[model samples]
Target: MSEYRVLVVEDSPTMRQLIVFALKRIRNLQIEEAGDGVGGLKKLSAHKFDLVVTDINMPIMDGLKLVSLIRNDPQYKDVPVVVITTEGAIEDRDRALALGANEYITKPIQTARILEVAKKMLGV
Candidate 1:
């Protein structure tokens, strides 16, 4: 089976590493990391990803802008995006959903929940 590619866009090093480690549980998953939205966009243009896992707060660019860009791009519109944010506010969740994210996950994510959401969206 081909490895599923996942792009993780997070500013915090610890959070980024945590996400990478958590997703590694999925066999045949290839992970890519980006520090912020700009880096995320650059990575996106360089390669196709099966899923995008992003954090809401970051410097240079944020998850919302990145989600907007992905949705706006014709070529990348089909790519599934799962927003992992600290903002648990209903408005934030609604905004992310309205921005075209396939799923929204709050911070301090459990490994099982991450796996569930990933499998649910990617149909693994």
Candidate 2:
């Protein structure tokens, strides 16, 4: 049985793979991947997840927009979102958090950091 479901939204295949690998270490997780925020939205609409991990910059849509949509939409409201991105600026972190991301980690990402945040966000 799955203990949790996590959606990883990243445009880069390599980055997405890395995030998936980290999430898999948590055990009992059903992980889903999306190429961008638009795809993330589609996945969210189709299924329920305990967490969302996204990258800040991407084509079609971005993490900020995803967070806003998730936070404002009643269907997705209260879901935890973690933004892992190369955009390490203070403003970028502030923006993502203000938009309702539960956690923000700038690249290059540490394996333990991602896993730690994921566990904390999921209450595991």
Candidate 3:
């Protein structure tokens, strides 16, 4: 069986580490990390990922624009993007959904919930 690839885009090194740690706990999980949306886009374009977890606020580019780009690209249109961000506002959630995020979760994340969502989405 192939490992499930996950792209994690966040600005904070600590948060990124936390996410990486949580995801590593799952078996057959392969992770790639990016510091911002630009890096995320670069990675996305370079490789195929089964799932993406991105932050809303980032330098150079934001998660919304990155996700919109992903949705707009015919090649990557069907890829599932999960927004894990600090922006808990209703409008932000609506915007993310509109931009093609399959799911949204607030920051200070619960690792178990993250795992559950990942498992449900990835069917692993």
Candidate 4:
């Protein structure tokens, strides 16, 4: 199987673990974790990731800013981003999409749903 790298950015350790656990079920996937958006950006600079799954409410920098930065950076501009957050409003969803997030998932997320989305995004 081809190897794929995925980055999970979330301030909550439990949430991050949950995401990583779900992602681990996919064959040949290498997962990386970041506590916040700044760390996520650092990882992005150090290595290329096939997909980025981030939570919006992180400290230092929020996921929206990260999405915007990723969209602006030519190297990562084409990379797929999935925003997972507690923000369920239409505006929040629209803003994330406007900032170039490929997919938006609200909190209380199902592992199966996230797994499905991740697989679809990675084309696994």
Candidate 5:
């Protein structure tokens, strides 16, 4: 079977590593990491990814814009984007959902939940 791919976008190296660790539980995944939304976009355009896990606040670009862009672009419109953020504000979650994020995960994360979401999103 071809390996499924997941793109992770976050400014913090530690958070990125943590997310990768959580998601690595899924076998045969080719995970890509981006420091921020701009970098994420570049990678997104360059590759076909099955899922995207991103943080909302970052330099250059933010998760909201990324989600909007993904939704606007026909090529990636249907891709599942999971927004992981430190903010637990209701507005933030609403905005991300409105922008087309499939899931919004707050910080202080439960790794297992992320894994579950990933499996459901990828139908793995």
Candidate 6:
């Protein structure tokens, strides 16, 4: 079986735990957690990841900025990003998508939905 690495970026410990727990359901996945976008970028720099699941609102840096940075970097440009955020507004969703987020999921996320999206993005 092939192994995949995933980075989960969220400031809230509880929310991060929930996301991590949900992601653990997938087979052959090695997940990492980052409390904020700056940390996420550091992890991205240190290691390659198959996918990134992030929240829009965070201290220091936000998910949209992270997505934009990831998109701009040649090394990580093609990597898929899923933004799971409390920003449910259409403009927020549109901005995330425009910033190269492959998937944009609103907050109060369904674990099943995240799993489905992650599987599809990773081709697992």
Identify the leading candidate in terms of lDDT.
Answer: 4
Residue pair clashes in candidate 2: none
As for model 5, its CA RMSD to the true structure in angstroms is 1.2
> Candidate 3: which stretches are off by over 4 Å?
none
lDDT by residue for model 4 (1-124), tens = 6499999999999999999989999999998899999999999999989999999888999999999999999999999999986755667678889999999888898899889999999997
Among residues 3 or more apart in sequence or in different chains, the pairs in candidate 3 whose N, CA or C atoms overlap within 3 Å are: none
For candidate 3, the lDDT comes to: 0.86
Clashing pairs in 6: none
Q: In candidate 5, which residue ranges exceed 4 Å CA deviation?
A: none
Task: Work out the TM-score per prediction.
Answer: 0.94, 0.96, 0.93, 0.95, 0.95, 0.95
Top candidate on TM-score is: 2
Stretches of candidate 6 above 4 Å error? none
Tens-digit per-residue lDDT, 40-80, candidate 5: 99999899999999999889998889999999999999999
Mind giving the per-residue lDDT tens digits that candidate 3 earns over 1-124? Answer: 5488999999999988888888888798889999999999889888889999888888899889988999999988888988876655667778999988999888778888777777777877
For candidate 2, what's the RMSD? 1.0
Candidate 2 runs further than 4 Å off: none
Span of ten consecutive residues with least summed lDDT in model 6: 84-93
lDDT of each: 0.89, 0.91, 0.86, 0.92, 0.91, 0.91
Q: Assess candidate 3 and give its TM-score to the true structure.
A: 0.93
Q: Which ten residues in a row have the lowest lDDT in candidate 3?
A: 84-93
Instruction: Tell me the lDDT of model 5 at 75.
Output: 97
lDDT (Cα, 0-100) at 7 in candidate 5: 98
Worst 10 residues of 2 by lDDT: 84-93
